[model samples]
Target: MQEQKGKYEDLKHDELGIKVRSDDNPYLSADLQQKILQPRRLSSYFIVLIESGSITYHLDSQDFTLTDGHLLFAMPNQIFTPPAKTGDLKYFKLLFDENTLALLPQQFPFLVNPSNAQTLVLDNPAKERVIKVFEILNQLLISDKYETDTEIILAYLNSLLSEFNSAYFKNKGPVNILNTNLSKFTEFKLVVETSLTEQPSINAIAEKLALSTNSLYRIVKEYAGTSPKDYFINRLMAEAQRRLRYSNTSVKELAYELGFNDPDYFSRLFKKSTGKSASDFLPRQDLSGK
Candidate 1:
């Protein structure tokens, strides 16, 4: 089955690179809801907080069932397939670009998703707090009064993310912003994301981060639950899945594009990582020329 090539969607209907919507919002028309049901690549950060009811969201090739108190987040360039029918689900959806994130006072480490956990379960107290923040954001974005102040929005956004960050790491123990090990792990993730196709060596990454290979391995395993080499391979496979799902890139081209010298080897590795051949993993559809 050939899937339709998914288009990359940017933040629309908002000037500040941010938009918030809730069940009560009148602007969420049937047409808009239908459009979201299509599988598309997102150009901005996407988040959904389920206040009530349940919906299964498809991100890349994974299905995440989000119900009450569950928050699902996806970063830029990810293939997202919203539920075909929300069916009375009360949810707060947020879309913000990298520019909007830049305006924040502090960096949000959880946004990088070091643990590779896309959904976070919030306790009752945290859930109530998050819902209030989301309500404020929705109101501010839709206010008919004089222009809504951008600073106020950022303040609330920062608060919302703080709640998320705390809840994200709550089980793992508090993350010390000053922890050098945590910083190194975050840097490792950034390097991998930026130079994924380059496939840099673990030793090279450790040297760049001013850490010994042993120390780097410990940090990555502790945070990501994978060895450095395995983490890099997983990242590569994920990118391959994204390209394969959203474009018509052939297996050979994908292999070379992802820095694999042998397309055959790439195919085997893909199968090993995902338990399915690249062709069988997802339908090959190329709607985007790029």
Candidate 2:
């Protein structure tokens, strides 16, 4: 079996760490656009709104079709494969890095993607509003004559994300911005992500988050449908899958990289979690957009 590794891409515009593209405007050059059509790992947040027509996008080996008034978003480090061709597709695509995200005054919880939904269906009114915001962002970033103030750009960006956050959570459930349980759950995910490699115990995580073991378990199970220990195992396995798909690192090296002391133990855990041996999991063919 031949391995197909994905190229890692970073934000092109370093000054703003953001880029917006629409049907009328081509953000990347012909060469870069071709690269985008291939399988790659993105180091920035990616969102696309389908205003009209339709297209299918390949993300992490799953195909998602978006039609008019639909939106799709992918977090950083996910494998992305743009459609090979867009026939009469009208859309808006936004890309921004974490550094750009930090400039906003308040955090948008939806960015954490608690619902595990990668796509949102926008109503007519919400669709119109989102399109208008995209147009404004497009004009602000692509202007050659006037250098838009960073503050002005950030304001529009903030508004656009707020709209997305609201629409994303509206149908899922009632979300109070100050809900204590939700906040604790979000904090738990963040802490796990921050120290994933360390493989902290459930009690340690609960202590760090100022929650009891039982409270942490309930919160994690409610949101993730798994206990705290299982959540950590699942997250580690997911990261392992991502790394395996994008790189040629051997099982031993990969285990050590993920902070596992014993390669055999990591292999067993991987098999238990993924139902495939580390070696059998490689040479993934779908990564080539097949």
lDDT of 1 by residue, 1-290 (tens): 01222321332324678888778873457878666677788888899899999999988879999999999999887888877546788999899988778767777778778878999999999999999999988888888776666677778988998899888888876768448888789889888877899999999999999999999999999988889999999989989988887777889999999999999999999999988799775565643322
Estimated TM-score for each candidate:
0.85, 0.90
Q: Rate the local accuracy (lDDT) of all candidates.
A: 0.83, 0.83
How far off is residue 92 in model 1, in Å? 0.3
lDDT of 2 by residue, 6-94 (tens): 32133233387899988889745887777777778888999999999999998875889999999999988678888855788899999
Cα miss at 29, model 1 (Å)? 4.8
Best-matching candidate per TM-score:
2
Instruction: Report the C-alpha displacement of residue 131, candidate 2, in angstroms.
Output: 0.5
Off by over 4 Å in 2: 1-14, 285-290
